[model samples]
Target: MSSMRLTGTPSWLNIKQRSARPGGGDDPSRGPQEPVRRVWAIGGGKGGIGKSFLAVNLATVAARAGWRVLLIDADLAGANLHTCLGVRGGNRVNLSDYLYDRVVDIDKAAIDTSVPGLRLIMGALDHTGMAETSRAQREHLFQALRKLPVDLVVFDLAAGADRATLDFFLETDEGVIIATPEPTSIENAYGFLRAAFYRRLARTMSTSPIRDLIREAMDRRNERGIRTPADLFKEIGQLDRGEEARFRQALEDFRPRLVVNQVRESEEIKLGFSMRSVCRKFFGINLEYLGYICFDDAVWRSIKERQPLVLAYPQSDAALYIRRIVHKMLGT
Candidate 1:
């Protein structure tokens, strides 16, 4: 397949051409049906933590595995996934168009990537207002995303623990948090995880009283003295004994995956395990330590070339580790 570029015409809307098997991990012998779609969102609390790089390479690896993939750059203000995939930026329709009602169908914003079986929906690169869309608009976007025709949809979220980013992360089948071993990144990761867990609990609770209590707990300096999710659960149990079961269920459901990036030493990889332990003990949330990627020069080289590391340096150590991470995610 040739690389897709934005032209003066509106023909980019019909750019779905797969060079590999159409169905993702489905039995081709069976009768035709819609591919089983899976969604994963990659996010973090700190900027410059390599979330986009990981998202691009992960989508490429999945596409190479014969899964039709749609990678969406959900980072409205900091959009750069298109550049990562070697797609030109100018005059192209993007996610902002859909949110602002400039485009009626979400598929119209999806442009073909150089990688076969993989396409990209560029973020609202030049639209600062996109970061402040209403909840209704976001809901509409999520609903439209579900109907997208693809085996997998990966969202590269904007950095931070903002409500919009967290909502996108929580809505996906698998939410992966990417962080480095730096002290600041680790701290922000914990903060992001905390915000996500509280958000989940607030949404899970039906009673206004319980939700108000959760909101109180979310404030670090609140008079309630609720410093952690475990503390919040205790208060919830005391406030409404019948809600304990629901609270526990919410805790059981919020399992976010972690990926430690740019590891310079073997000891740095253990950060994932440490964060997992902290989440289990303090927040009562089961954070899965998906895997880690070691620092490699090939990563920078591929970025300079504007190609995915998996395709540009498949033999490099970082590339091997990335493919391993993808396999672990797919259970293959």
Candidate 2:
């Protein structure tokens, strides 16, 4: 189909188009109705870690697989998914407009793209007070998202663990954290994961007195004098068995998947496993190592051409790696 720009559409119209779908997945009548499973968010603590690249290509592959997809560029401050998808058009209404103007509907801001089975909601260029979405707005967005008919909605989140990003990440059915093999990226990825868990726990137990106790325990330094989450969990376990059980249950439930990007060598690819181990050993958290995307020139070429690598070179190594990830995610 032809690609449409985000420049002049009304927010409601945008949402309607994005929610439209041409169905062709597994047979719908043979068994129980598969619940509409839209809304996947892609995020990372560090920038330039291939989060957006993965987001675009993942959406492309999902759409190509016959699942209607709505790709939301939730990185309001630095939205660029449209560029990666080779979309052209100045967005008239973005996430910023929806946030600032009470009358603007977020759905109206969404636009159609050239890729069949895929649609997009662009982010605002002027992100001036749009960093943190209010609780009401977030609820509105999620409620609206649930009503959409698309089979999959992918959000390309802004980098970092800011309150807004973390909140959005928590709202999704699954979250994918992207990181490179570099020490800095690895550390930041861990930090982001911890922060996300903490935020989620805080929200779930906002009224609990143990919240303060857990926070204080997390602040303590270990024998090596390094403050760590595991140390805090152990201390909390000693202090209150019930709280510890709750904490462990929360940890077990917070399964954030990982993607090690930009791997140049076999050793670099192994970093994904190493990082997964560190997360389990140090933080008592189990992270699913989704898969690795090796460093490939085709990725750079696709970026230069403003296209998704999976679309530009479907059979390339990078594309294969991404497809493996998709299979793992879908359990197919």
Candidate 3:
């Protein structure tokens, strides 16, 4: 039996502590709290990259290991994660209910799943306004997520590099980017990383003059010609030493995990490493290659049956790879 466990204060808790409100450490819930230990957000630049498949199976695998898990569909645009988890949605309270104040408690939106120790909070299905959630609303939702009575919370974020999507990706402890071995997918993945990297840098700069420069660099067509993060850092180093140090710290701290799905040939399996190298050389980012899942017929079959692959085909090659990825995330 695997002795791997994911319970306890997460490695990123120290970073959270630094930004935590003063004297806001205690849980105010009525009873003992089952504080969420880790959060994983699975997202990509484009749709159809198997993000939902990966999220559902990862949540299922963690739950089966006796850890309480909450799989939330953060994809407000196309909320089908309920279907992926084989849960029927019929007027059940969901994320929008909590966001829009229909439900005061986020726990009310939790729906029981077939897998024990696992629950789900469905995403907005019809609320078009959810895509434009205000910053306060997003922060409230994130605070509630930290207090959910589960060991892990996995967010199935929407596709694209929109501000809302990048915020969700940055807020989580583990930000996973799923992509395929196709040229278009790779291009979009790079775009997504650039957007996210700049977003993080902007958030790190507090009241600094370089903050405006970061914003300008976000626009690729800016007259400053600051195309990459390296170029921006070079400009910042010439401007202010204090801001330059902040930029260096943020660059070192921002590490996003990557997983290539539907991989087939050996070269495709090596795509993760190639991307990692390119990120280091071109973007000065440390991208962790968190293993990949091979192309398998069982993946689609599980989707067709509206069941998580780990549950529908536990013995399938895809399931095996998914479990391995989960273990890697757990650092076991």
- TM-score for every candidate vs. truth? 0.90, 0.83, 0.89
Model 3, residue 124: distance off in Å is 1.6
Best by TM-score: 1
Candidate 1, which ten residues in sequence have the lowest lDDT sum? 1-10
Candidates' C-alpha lDDT: 0.82, 0.74, 0.82
Candidate 2 positional error at 16, Å = 34
Instruction: Tell me the deviation in Å of residue 169 in model 1.
Output: 0.4
lDDT of 1 at 20: 35
Query: Model 3: residues >4 Å from true position, as ranges?
Result: 1-34, 127-130
Which parts of model 1 are misplaced by more than 4 Å? 1-36, 127-130
Rank by TM-score, highest first: 1, 3, 2
Clashes of 1: 0
| Candidate 1: tens digits of C-alpha lDDT, residues 1-332 | 11111112222112222223445344566322464357889988899999999999999999998777899898989999999889999979998888889999888889999999899989876857444988788899888877766778899988888888888888874889998999999998899888988888888899999999989998999998999888887888898987888999988888788989888876786798889898898888888887778778888889999999999989877787787778777766
Task: Please list the residue runs of candidate 2 whose C-alpha ends up more than 4 Å from where it truly belongs after superposition.
Answer: 1-36, 101-105, 214-226, 234-242
Pairwise lDDT winner, candidates 1 and 3: 1
Q: After superposition, how far is residue 121 of candidate 1 from its true place, in Å?
A: 0.5
